[model samples]
Target: MSTPGRGLHGRVLDTLGPAITAGEYPAGSVLRTDELAQRFEVSRSVMREAVRVLESMHLVESRRRVGVTVLAECEWNVYDPQVIRWRLAGSERPRQLRSLTVLRSAVEPVAAGLAARLATPEQCAELTECALGMVANSRGHRLEEYLFHDVAFHRVVLTASGNEMFARLGGVVAEVLAGRTHHDVMFEDPDPAAVTLHVQVAEAVRARDAERAERLTREITEGALQELDILAP
Candidate 1:
């Protein structure tokens, strides 16, 4: 998050954000603005602005005359999507995946229940369509196609919940889904049981069966957690 700016600041933030998260600049390491400016062929002002963005993420601390210092892993705002992306891109991926799965488990089941209670007929129909698309893509061994529908299904659940805070988390849900696929954590051939459960959940939401919606959603997230466990080294 580079202060919503343009050009050099974005470039510097892009280059350095992941690098720091990936431990190229490990905890407590100092980043000299002059050195970074020279290395990136940018002006000092631009480099300082970039550092300010990193500081906002709590990845680093800039002090007058003390240079910008990389903070400990615990100090970062891990929920920030940029931070999560950087961690996913690094060796810390397994831990990040587990953390995100825990979050998904905690939120999505409740969202599904609320969707059942609150979603309009049109929203419900779209959710069902997404679920059906997932089943079709899974049967065809189309992993990427399956992922698109899968992401849509979850996004619909959140949005249809009629809760602004929960709806706002759709981006986070999308990131986790895409991240799993990108990291090859997702099965190449989608799980048949998982596909069935998705359809069941969609139907439950359509029928306004809150209990079934919640239960089925929990089952889906549990399956995901199990996969993460199996993949964990």
Candidate 2:
């Protein structure tokens, strides 16, 4: 719902967030509100809101005399949406992808397994619809379709997981996928085998086979990572 340029505060935050993340300010470097407002062509009030957002993200700390200073990486709230966006926009390094994939590997399969045990009939139907949508859109280079189904598929898995923590992972998943989408990294042909694996996971969930669902989910995620490596190379 948040459109680019609509909110001055968000735009300012987006601009400054990346600068800090990319080390333009660096750790302990002071950020001047007036300088940033001038740089981004925004008013001080908008700039202040952006600074507040950054503070919440732990990217910058505001002090009375020193202005705002960038924090160390360990202090950052990586899970914050703005922080994730900044990271994605700051660089395109394989190490970032690898780190995200590792996180996914740890979380998604367990989510899938839990969803298998907990999904309601309606959720199962929605999951099937999402999978079928993927198959339908796989024919041409329908990137949005792929992304839609891909996001939906994962959302269902998270919902089925019956854990609020797992559901909260949706933001991270969306952020990573948005980056991949911007890079035109979704499968051009919609890998049938991958789609089939998704279906298998869906079926396992429908059947309440938690173990199979988890195993299939892991396989699907790992396969995608392998393909990403090949493509990025």
Candidate 3:
């Protein structure tokens, strides 16, 4: 989820971010910058910059002499896509995916309702196009393509809701969708019913039927939950 860590400091985060999220460094664990510099073979300056990035993410806090202390998970900005990506790759995958699906269920239905009422003509057109792209890629080992459209479709819906809070979740939703496709129990073709429901949700949004849009979105999220139970449990 991070850019390729070719930059010196970037390389440190590429290792440390996931390792911290994966619990390699538990809460309250203290790491000396000098030791980390030696281990990663980076200069002290590069290591310090990496620690600063982690601090910004609330993953760690650096002090003058106390070294870097891993923060409690509750302090982390879990919405960061990189944190989600790392968790989804670790032993925490099942739990992380479930939590994110539950979050989507709670937020997306309401966002779709708002989108139906507030979306501009241009947004409506974009929704239909994304829905069609999803349809075209719904079968025959085309998950990567379907995922592209699915993420776009939801991003547009959340953005068109006219709430900046909802709009900010687009990346979170994208990570969840990508996790489902690339890391979760989804191995076969996407559910046709889910695809159909997305198209219907788009139709309802375009028609400005907020109630219908909400209801259809609820169905989509419920189906996602059902898939987790049936496929992973």
Candidate 4:
């Protein structure tokens, strides 16, 4: 739950958010701000700020008379990057990764098709550059670098789609890709065929081959799902 670059309030969120998503505080559970502050050894103000952040994510609702009530998972903004990160950090990570991959399967192929049709020359260049980066880092235990390009590749595809809704999923896609790399589930080297597929998708998009782009992107996401199934802990 603890990563760098977080302030005091963010630290509280780092701990508390993962706990909530992990069901340590189940749905309908009421949490007192003051008690939580005391338990975390933080001031009430910090706790309040943390609670406010969670409220925005619909993970909890603050009631004046009552307390912060944990909402059901159905009500959560699962696409929120922070929420996605917290979920990936928790015990439910395998399921979380699978669910996110399924989401990509649903959205990214269409996005890829649109990118093929609408991508600007600059965006197409970016896609090719990202693909080359992935190829460069796919082996020799260069996972972190490969992950960077992988996340960027998907983000470029989404943004080039000319759809704001799909574009906003950049962060969601980022968290999922980072989760797979950081968590122990991935292979030492990324799957070779998967890397090749990314390159092909990039080429298809650059060529303005909408149908091929969509099909290749579908293959990428399908491989991700299969990866989760094969690598599930």
Best lDDT among the predictions, by candidate number: 3
| TM-score, every prediction | 0.90, 0.86, 0.91, 0.86
**lDDT tens readout by residue for model 3, 1-233:** 65677789987888788899999988999999999999999899999899888999999988888989999999999888778878878888888888888889899999999999999999999999999999999989899999999999999999999999899989888888998888766799998999999999999999999999999999999898887773454
The predicted structure with the larger TM-score, 1 or 4, is 1
lDDT of 1 at 175: 75
The number of clashing residue pairs in each candidate reads 0, 1, 0, 0
lDDT of 2 at 91: 66
Q: What are the Cα lDDT values of the candidates?
A: 0.87, 0.81, 0.91, 0.90
User: lDDT by residue for model 4 over 15-130, one digit each (tens)?
Assistant: 78889999998899999999999999999998999999999999999999899999999999988877888888779888887887888899999999999999999999999999
Estimate, for each residue in 1-233, the C-alpha lDDT of model 1 and write its tens digit. 12433689888877688789888877989979999999999999999888888999999999989899999989999978778877877788778878888888989999999999999999999999999999889865588899899999999999999999888778877877887777656656888999999999999999999999999999999988887773445
Provide the lowest-lDDT 10-residue window in model 1.
1-10
**Against the true structure, what is every candidate's RMSD?**
2.9, 3.0, 2.4, 3.1
Q: What's the best-to-worst order under lDDT? A: 3, 4, 1, 2
Which pairs clash (backbone N, Cα, C closer than 3 Å) in model 3?
A: none
TM-score, cand. 4 vs. native: 0.86
State the TM-score for model 2.
Answer: 0.86
Candidate 2: where are CA atoms >4 Å away?
5-7, 37-46, 92-94, 181-187, 230-233
Candidate 1 contains a number of clashing pairs equal to 0
